[model samples]
Target: MVGDSSYGAMSIEELVKFFQTGKVVGFPTDTVYGMGCLLSEDCVAKLRELKKGREKPFAVFVPDVDSAKELVEEFPNYINSLIKKHWPGGLTLIFRAKKGLPPGVVSGEGKIGIRIPDFPPLIEAMKRVGSPVINTSANLPGEVPPVSHKDVRVPLELMLKGDSKGGIPSTVVDVSGERPVIIRMGAVKVFEIEAITGKTILLSEGNVLNILYVCSGNTCRSPIAQYHLSYCARDLPLFIRSCGTLGFSGSPATENAIKVMEEIGVNLTAHRSTPISRELIQWADLILPMEPVHREEVLSLGANPYTILPFYEIIDLEKIPDPIGKDIEFYREVRDLIVKGNRWLEKHLRERFNP
Candidate 1:
């Protein structure tokens, strides 16, 4: 995720050429190691051979949300909420493919699964290649997918220098239907998908709702959101709490935060910060992390990528500054930002919970 992705001994220039020349590359994803070849006719044939008699079609790695719409014929607006919240992660959306796709890349149903991973190094290569790649886990038919490059058994000319602590598979959903069908249950949970689409999720577990708000210290942004949302959340089947990424246990809210909430007629006087925990992650139906780093923290705690809302990414909400040690005016400014962000979140919640 740092600078140039470690693609074995391949240089960036060499890597770009390798992909452009219809060759395959072995790389890692948020979940497991994978091999991908561009949709060029020759490359797809190579991928097909490596894939080895797998009847299912391969998913494509989309560069971003915009490109996803471009590739999918008459993309559905109903799936926008899920795209914004969970694309570029472990959720692969199935869409109707536009004309002129190569032979074996899509299903007989004329659909293709597209996913934008949360990782950057992998995506950068995709951008350079400027076409969708035949993205699938690097494994033969009926075999387990490898989590690390060393474990990959396929004969790959290029290898990305990376190791993975294998996470869950990308959750595949067919959104082309009248109702979204869970094609495959992977990292993203069923309830999280239901929450985004405003549909009811039914599974083995009963539907007790849990919500988590996360930030740096939990004294400012997240706690403010937690207490305010709590007032309106009473009638719903929700359990709400706030936590910090690097917070101390039982820390009190900042004075400026307390004063600003007072002006809004909300209380932050009883707020105390708690560090994020696995128990909390497993309990939550949805997570709203204040920043990107906090999103990573949630993943570390084993929360599904889709379950945690990358709020800053979801709505293009700019950075909400930490006003913990700043002046009263700074605190007020940051408070205003949180208020604005929370307003949008609340509107979405109303439509989701009530509808």
Candidate 2:
């Protein structure tokens, strides 16, 4: 039994030791307390034996985005979108399990609940363990979930003492079908979930032109193109957003880039970086990646939202040159490319909207 200040105090080695030995440990999450075991066939059996509970479906908690991608079969666009928007927090997603997950974990339901909690201790422990851990409420079947370590029963108390520092459980979301359905609302609110999945009133409703722009960094090319398209379509009606294939969230645009755009009366100072997400793809009627490789990266996320090289249909260029750290000449070159691209896009939009 490990006893210390908080679950965050326990070393990764200690947590891995307990999980690898097939012991269930109570841990904190973003919402309430949860019991977890390594998702091995033998571990699953041992967890069931230890709990002496009915054979109901259970969820699993992963360490990070990459780990979640490995456990489930081709994640749908909607699910990917949700993960990007709500992961590393309390949102638990339930999906149809592929062959890899043990049948007992899901109780033969062909579905599995999975989450990536925001807690540092749990993330570190999962990283050491190298697999998704079984995640269910710490309490026995049909009982209220334990909100704190003190609320857990003696047996669970023993398990935590032996293996973990008690932590909270994550909020759960079921995405096993068409739309995301909330199973349990915890730390993450219901409206937050709706914000990501809900449909908005279309301005003109003809085809609802959805556009996504992708580049190396969202700061310059993609965002500029995004705004350019939106500006050109001000008289027309279209849904447009810009993002990067590998951009950080909430980061600001580059200084020189902003300076140049300011000269053009484009206030990109308010633009913040956002990475390409599953939701972005789903929301887009057309995906305009800056290069072929970026187009491939977008496709790898999931299907739909026909990805294309932004200038492929207009010209034969295969890649967009990176304008970072370049002089004014380089910026001018990029601006020229953007202008050409937008001109082509304008024609395309006219065809789609006017025709």
Candidate 3:
């Protein structure tokens, strides 16, 4: 609507032709205006060039439920109920991707976001094209998404006319994992989704807490504690990192530590030691050091007293002694202690975050 009459006046036949030729179009969606082209290697490349430097994976708009079902690897059983209640509205669902989707439409973890929009004109255009199309919000990175046809600034081979609900975007729920996580809350209310799913939706990202675990050599206790809680509380909004007060950076976890963790089903083979620094201390919402001396060391480097706590004190366990250079049996003892402490930590996180 904001463009010159000549450019905005493209017909449906012309729009379909443009899609065939890998050109993008702007159209109104139930939530907002969106710009995209039918999915293809060339089309996705062009779309990526248009939104230069943006890294978030694009969502694809399917014409109907059947198209969406074909796009994902396998639908979760609960998804049928959610679709029955919310499809053709403002909900974008993420599922494990079926193979052969172009990289631009698939997340790094190989998931795809698929939405069946309520907007009739867009649906008609997709049906004509006979495939799903990239449906990213019609704006560049860091810019507000256009709510009306006239607000759209991207160049398009055609601009389809329709009324969007405006203001709020669609709620994005990732069903790719064991538990569904709401990555973005938008037009649909959380309680509404909860009511349909009959389960509490964990918020995956907003207001996340950064937890830093510190030990003498990041090789052992801290990494054990970090990885254990990370796997146990994977659904919570917490970012876990570990470092050592006295250990060298980039050092792998000691062989015993890695072997012992594997016995308990936690992987520590890939962990590299990060030496504690002011930046890390400042980044943490909570810093759990292996012993009182490590806490004292961090405090000397200006960590806030409230944010830094000795692991023993919080878990009500005896101080974790350094197991560096110790035998494999000694390392196993240390790993068990960290595992017990991490169970306490995981409970504390769930109670605090209400996930």
Candidate 4:
């Protein structure tokens, strides 16, 4: 009704009414073209028939957080954190299904995947329908899902003509397990997930090294090391973050730290300090701390002893001192030290990750 003229067009209100009455419709999503219907048994059966008898559990499209909450069993704090950061976008979270969902809504393992899609009109339609809809890619199983409404092969009662910001499918995270597991890697990267929940996430793709750099305030040493190493090892399979053991959250990197990094063409102006958290310590495959005291703090936060390696100790270099109140020259010296350490680390990571 919105764009393509091949099919019968309908107003959004009419579309909502059709959905409420269990008619399948095709539409654009933030990620790709999709077809959906109400979660009623007859509607789900028709949706499956349209997809050529595919039987994989379909993701439920919920309009809002409250709607999502009603469909799943209780979730953990980290799941809530991920929802806060990634919802209304291209991330689908799977949780243990609560009882009494429609037959096709829950997988055999009793888990249900749900997403609050970024598309405004579709979300509004679901909100108006007052029930979750069964959403699946707009193609037969094993076929490339359509990115535009015109490319859709499956016939529907109506196709809401629109464009899809197609890249990869939504990233799927399963929180029904003892730990969060990434069953599918799509639009969202592993590093972005780690930044939000501070838990190292392994993909079905393979292993990825996660490094957490720590310092006193996160404004000087750790930021320098994090940015320098990130720039040097841009292609490696690594996720890097910096935090302060005894630091203020949301504090910007010092002027000296920013200026020194600029000399080497690495931008530190965007770096903001975050205090080291238990989630962060748990997330790191390797924890590189600026000083021995920082390493001790990381250990105090329940980090594995094997994971906490002081940077100077590991590289056999003298400890890089903090340059908070020091002159620009001192900051430059610190930057040089971090560069030397990062150079050694880069070569080591290259050998290990082979990226």
Best by TM-score: 4
Cα displacement (angstroms), candidate 2, residue 87, comes to 1.4
Model 2 lDDT at residue 332: 66
Q: Which structure is stronger by TM-score: 1 or 2?
A: 1
Candidate 4 contains a number of clashing pairs equal to: 0
Candidate number achieving the greatest lDDT relative to the actual structure: 4
lDDT of 1 by residue, 1-355 (tens): 1123455334455556778877788877887788888776676778878888566777888778877887778676667888787777788988898878875767898998889877666676678878767788888877788887778888888877666534568878778765666677676776678868875433222234568988998888888878877765555556788899885789999888899889888889998899989988876768888887888889988887757776565557654567778998988887777666667766666543453
- Residue-level lDDT tens digits of model 3 in 165-273: 7557998998886566878867665545665676656766575767999988788889988998888899988899999888588999889888898998889888999
Report the alpha-carbon TM-score of model 1 versus the true structure. Answer: 0.57
Q: What is the lDDT of residue 199 in candidate 1?
A: 56
Rank all candidate structures by their lDDT, best first, as comma-separated numbers. Answer: 4, 3, 1, 2
Per-prediction RMSD in angstroms?
A: 11.3, 13.6, 13.3, 11.8
Report every candidate's CA lDDT. Answer: 0.75, 0.67, 0.80, 0.81
> Under the 3 Å rule for N, CA and C atoms, how many clashes does model 1 have?
4
